[model samples]
Target: MATWSDFENAEPEMAEAGKKLLYQFGVGLAFLATVRKDGAPRLHPICPTVVNGRLYALIVDSHKRNDLRRDGRYALHTFPPVDVDDEFLVMGRAKLIEDPEVAEMVRKDQVARGMTSTNDELAFEFGIERAMHAKYPGGHGTWPPKYSIWKER
Candidate 1:
């Protein structure tokens, strides 16, 4: 859990640094998650997304999608290298969102980035729940990752 005071008083530059690092490397690593039915964790490589001031992913024809449709609960993890032996890990929950407009926006973004097929496979959005971050190499200092709680309208 995070407190408002923590994020509120954070240096603007520091927060930007952390976000840049995460966003830069968020695309490569597999997002580890668990579905509701079996409660078994799974992993999927995702293209990092920042939409409507929130983070999301356009999941296409994945079991993750099926799980999200059934239950809008999941977790994600990613590691981005900062330097030799210096890296950061992000863990968080994800919620599914289904909307035609949002789906179209995501599709356009994906196509622009050469990620998704132009077909009609788009169906869901994984909205962030709570994000936790930790840095490696011990002496790097600390600033807790920002966690976002989703409220679907």
Candidate 2:
């Protein structure tokens, strides 16, 4: 599996603007991955919000939802957009938290974004493993080794 050693050492946390950029234009681009009943990895996209280093998402009766219910193992994928056509990927593990107040807050945000109106959804916290950034546009600005991640040696 890919590890952190292969990537550049960004600070323990991203800059405030960088963090916000990941969420601003990344509403519908957040993806979740989990294991299916048969034990295969399944990936799905959903509306997501970040709070205190956790990613909260809502899905309507999705296969991924079932997978997450069966197993808390999941990941959140987000891309940070750049004006120079650059892309950054954040990879991490996730855990679902079932709290009425938290769920209600997420539901309210979802409604505001026109994503959903029900509070019957799941909330997750992702332990970010690594972040990889690369230049896009397929030109001289692109960097070598297209992408990398944080992993244990």
Candidate 3:
């Protein structure tokens, strides 16, 4: 289990490529895939934040959160670009972010955003096990795009 910082240190180019695709929309937009209790697959949109030397996502009380709690394995993929198929994908483990200060900061941010704030809020830190980024041409559908991939040693 490696933090985003660790991943960056290990493979800066790949990490940067993935990060760019992730935040291409001016926000950390990606879809999170988690394992359900019954071994089914569950997915949800998430905003990944890279701060404090790690990757975190604010997922309030929900089945997705529970999935992470019970099983940390996850796969997160960036949303498709408006035209190009450039995208990023990461597969790794997730753990609850328990730092009080970090939690407070997130709570405040949520409040400022006018989103519902509650004690049920759960912050998760994602550890990167592997990642890949694809760069497509014509900013649209293009197969066999350039791919940069990395994995933990």
Candidate 4:
């Protein structure tokens, strides 16, 4: 697994493209998929933040949070584009961020971005195992969209 920084350092363009797709509306948003205790998949909207080159999400106490606590495996897909089929997907494992200093930094970043967060929210940092970015310049009309896939090497 690789940190966001490591992925970015290896493939800056891919990382930036993925980041752009993730934060398409000036705020980060993605569909986070986790595994339920019954081994089923659970999907939910999440606001993902890339701070100091690390990907973090603030999750309140819920089934999603509990899911991560029990099983860290997750896959994140960008919300569909308004006028295009361009998409980004990442597969990774999440680690709960417990260090006070790191959480404080994230809080400051969220405040600066005008995003509201509560004290009950827990932070989780994602470690990327691989990612795929697809660009559909011609939208649905295109025969095949350009694809760029990256894996930790």
The lDDT values for all models are 0.50, 0.56, 0.83, 0.89
Better of 1 and 4 by lDDT: 4
Measured by lDDT, the strongest candidate is 4
**Candidate 2, 1-153: lDDT as tens digits:** 222222223443332333454566635355567778888888877676655444566655667777766676666555545444445455555556667787677677667665655555676545556555443556445545344334423
TM-score quality measure for candidate 2? 0.64
TM-score of structure candidate 1:
0.62
Q: What would you estimate as the lDDT of candidate 2? A: 0.56
| lDDT of prediction 3 | 0.83
On TM-score, the leading prediction is: 4
Q: Ten residues in a row with the worst lDDT in model 1?
A: 1-10
Model 1: lDDT of residue 12: 39
For model 1, residues 12-88, the per-residue Cα lDDT tens digits are 33334445554664333335465747787666766655455445567767687777777666665555555532332
Clashing pairs in 2: 3-150, 3-151, 4-150, 4-151
In order of lDDT, best first, we have 4, 3, 2, 1
Clashing pairs in 3: 83-139, 83-140, 84-139, 84-140
In order of listing, the candidates' clash counts read: 0, 4, 4, 0
Off by over 4 Å in 4: none
